[model samples]
Target chain A: MQYAERILDAIDMETFILARDEGEAKGFMGRFLADLGFTDHDIVFLEQVGPGVRVRARAYIHRPGGSYGWLAEGDDNGG
Target chain B: MVAEKKKILLVPLDPVHDMGLKLIRKALDDKGHSTVLLPPGMEPYEVVERILDEVEIDFVLVSRTLGYRVGELLARFVDLVEVSGLRDRVTLVVGGMAVRPELAAEMGFDAGFGPGTTPGEVVAFIEDRPFAYGGRAEASEGGKRDLTHGFSYVYRKKEIQKRLAAIAGDIMGWAANKTSPGVERARLRFQALNKGEKYREEFLEEYLDYCDELVVLSYKRKQLPDQTRFLAQDELHFLKQYQNWEGRSKAARSGIRKPDVFIQYGTGCPLMDIMHIKVCEAWGADGLVHFDPSGGARTEGLLEGYLAHGEDGTLLTWENLRLIKNFLAPNTLWQVRAHRGLNTPETVVLAGELGADLTKINMAYASLGAGMDPARITIDGVEAIRWAAHYDLPFDVVTNEELSGVPAHKAFAGMLIIAHLALQLGGRPILQPLFCRSPEVMIYGQMRDNYIDYNAAKILALQQIIDAPLWPGAPIGFLTHTEDRVQSSLTTALHASLARSLGVEAISIASSDEAYAGGPIAAASRVDTLRATHEAFRFFGRAGIQPTPRAREWSKELIAGISKVLKDVANSGSFVQSLYRGLLGGPEDGAYPGRVGRDTLLRKEKGKDV
Candidate 1:
């Protein structure tokens, strides 16, 4: 099983990024997730605080009705 | 076998916050190891000098509360130790509020323990044994609680009890000669499953005769409904793997005594439901309520097989239920709801046979809110109660009609009637009042002041009349949540804490996806509310949320309203007729008599089958 597939559901990444506004925070989150090689992701929560934005990003490893990689047999991704 | 005691040195690197080291020192002493404790605010070089000056030390445990310059300080300490030639002589470990094992390893320390590390872990490290975090031993501490455990099922108000008895007697008489296809199927299912294979074929033939054509075709020809299919073998295999992988670990609780928590799971697919169930179980949910499809309720008969649906509620089938039941933790209470459906009796039968701990049955809700015919549901509901009692399954009489815009008083009246009927039939029934922002509340502005007073009023009113178990649900915080996960989870947590403060037996809470109608509830959403509720419980441990004096006044009014409703039903002479006549809850009150099983009851002749 791949290491990423081992995540039972979605992976939620919460962080505070130095951004001017909500839009900038979303952009930073999108770029950050893309940089991390996350293709399937969404912004679950976002808030603009004083100097930065508090953000919660979600990348779904497996969704219902989709064939789960963890269930499939293959070489271990060693996540 | 006792291991050889070794010299251990405990050093508190932090000027303050030396409690962690002190705890470890006590544990090391208990393990019969000689330990030297260094006072706080000692310089890193002084610690190294003490370690070098001392005799052979087995392990050096240093505790540091992480701060801005603490990392640099620790690195310098490690450099000093390396220069002093004691680096390889002893195992070096660091632990504190912010120290992670990875950080320690990066800084050339042997090991690190962060917050929540127990003393036993340090002892295990000293003994050279592998330490597992959150051991399964603590998981076994929680056991299934009986929600109906100390309630006497006695009516405190004599007037309500007298009126309810009269109505219950009328219901018993009215249902004496009445039987529906639901009741007959339940009987045949019991006989077919228990008697033998010969009886099974004969009973199935008779069973299909009473079912609708759709159910008959699905059973006889092995054809499934649209958007449904039998679960693949690999799906079941993966599910078993997931269950075993999670293992038996109990979710951590917040330390309050009353109100066991429950979460509802019905993600259409049994596989998905099991996944959600496992998450809820691991996050301290005390019980689970199974929500089957709304279509399944309106349909005449249930489909068979390990089927998965592509919609909201899980399909209610014996195989499907058995699969879910097999994977639940031993201590997790499972409730298969038979409250609002054409197959109420058979649902209860399946739940009972499959080892379900509780079931839900409400004739008034089924008839008025869920669209089942008044007479049909009464007969089936009565039979369901009988089977529930026979199987020793305690059911909850849920008053969700309030969500349909019925006032709390009318809904409670209906709930108490079904509860009294269940009691009359020797069944234990828990009263479930919804802790929600119902439409009635919106219309009447009952909660315009605060949420606490009105909810507390409902509980007080019920307590004034009866002494049964009160479980505020289907899901509390109904209509109060939004699409925001934070808001939804917080609302659910607040309602849960309020329910606990009211000292109810149990509460069914919603996922953080309660108000998010865009898609199916994600597995992570279930953990959000559970975590929030855990925090809420921790925040308000034994400190009550006080409802104002208006609660008592509302309670008195609610009791009077319920009394008036019960009296009307008693005077009507038949419970079914009262339901049809809208004595309990009428069209104006937002409850309309359902017509799904209209005129479906058959009168039984003396010693003859219908």
Candidate 2:
């Protein structure tokens, strides 16, 4: 019934961050995930391109080997 | 029961986007339905008036692709249909890239088809029948494909074949009367699983002697290894709920029958693995290969229970395998690797009893690449091959030892010997050559010009030696991927494209996180490679990827090299001694005989290992 429970696993957020380097991009992403109320998160990828950093951030709504509420009674199976 | 066709009206409600509607109209016409098409840019009022002018239009199909104010425009059109009092008479359907089923239903449309909507799906909707999405989403209809269905498994070149046969004979002769604790455990496991619950304790009493302390702790106290845990009662119930849930999945391939894309899943937890399997299956993965923890391989035995781990490899357990197996889409080919482990034969027994479609066993890779003693693994691997035959499980003899700097010819020599030994033991063996950017390539610059020719040469060379099914990988494109998801996925997709061109039957593909060693693979990373592979297959369906003339030269070199290695292995007094002396691969070649399970081979007495 909860929105987070709708996701079968984790959700990945990919975007471009205006940062000087990979470390700065990672710092911004950590804050971004924190500001978005995510705790179980990781910066899966970060690369410093010409002007900005291309990054893929992930929030683990459900870690593996744990209970998946998404598997519970539901109409929409989220990816 | 076939539904009777009726008159239909197709309206492309957007400018210059009538392609979907035109496709639907053609499909409807093919199904003997009457249809009138209004070109793109038709006003909603004009469409409504046209429907009204028609003497009994059973259906009105509208397509809208332009997204700006689309919801409001659709809502206004639905209100117009309602005001006309014709909503009850006509089944109003909406479809296009901008449409969602819920959004259309909320807008008062009868149904909606979104992007990637096929023509047959629209027909299924109009005919009021359930669309099974080629029976892939729900049931099997020609879906349980055999990867080795047509391969003849005959040697093409007689000289190489003669050498391979002699080498394999020497290896089998050496392995014939040899046994190990691993083999003993496999026999005990076979007895335990078959003989009823009453005999379990008795079986474990004998089986535990062979198991390491960590494994014993897991069974006796229900204790878990580091970073691993057993699923709680509530979590198990949730998995049970998943067992009854029916979901949809499209095939990853765009219609090419060979080269089924297989993904590896083992997030150290059966629950996590099930989730990954669900994701991979839904994304069109045709098969799943179970990856056990490397530590578990070095350990003497496997554990049981619905275990979850915080690491990369899933712990090999009968309970874990059965739990994951229960959730696999019936059509997805399941491969439980019995390769590179102390429990090789035992894993085969578990994989077989649990209805696995395939198993992987390569004694050479086990000894040289995975750090298992050549002598111990050879004894157990031979037993594992026999069990593979008994269980009707065709296994891939992977030449991943090349990753440790072994050349393709030497690795292929080992692979061919094992494959030949499997044939002699009545087991079907698939040749798994790596389409990798391996150590050999980095050292020799064989792949400097392109990743295609050397890979093509490997396949071409193997084809000359034997007619067995070729499946190019245990995660193709190894050592070529980087931590960058795009690069990782692209390399995987490109290698898969090459595999399709070379006519391979299956390939073990890595997730987009293949190069990332810092964490367990993310679900999104898996999707990246699967989607890329799907696109690649779609992009290059039967077009063929051409390798340069260098491929023929490399193929000839590889064949000659394999023949020389096979001759040396056959001439060696003892096959086990040859492995120790590095006849298959040597120290300079970045390969050394394994130390794990070294000097552990036990002699069999009266058909039982002592």
Report the C-alpha lDDT of model 1 over B1-610, residue by residue, as the tens digit: 7877989999998887688888899998999999999999999999999998899998999999877888999989999999999999999999987676657887789988776578988898899875533312333454577889989987789999999999999989988998888998898888877886778679878889778888898988988889989889987886676565343233334445458789999999998888777767766787899999999998888888899989899999988999999988777889999989999999999999999999999999888789888988999999999999999999999888888878888888999999999899999999999999999999999899889999999999998888899999979989999989899999999999999889999999999899988878976677779879877887888899999999999999999999999999898888888888888888898789899888778876642443
| Candidate 2 local lDDT, B227-345, one digit each (tens) | 88878989978677556445445656766676788999988888878877777777778899999989999998888887787777888888889889888877889999999989999
In model 1, what is the error at residue B573, expressed in angstroms?
A: 1.1
Model 2: how far is B455 from its true place, Å? 0.8
Q: Estimate the overall C-alpha local distance difference test score of candidate 1.
A: 0.85
Cα deviation of B272 in candidate 2 (Å)? 1.0
Return the TM-score for candidate 1, rounded to 2 decimals: 0.83
- DockQ of all models, two decimals each: 0.03, 0.03
**In candidate 1, what fraction of native interface contacts survive?**
0.00
- TM-score, candidate 2, is 0.88
TM-scores vs. true structure, each candidate: 0.83, 0.88
Give the least accurate 10-residue stretch of model 1 chain B, judged by summed lDDT. B131-140
Show model 1 residue runs off by greater than 4 Å.
A1-79, B1-10, B19-37, B41-45, B48-61, B65-94, B98-139, B196-199, B246-252, B606-610
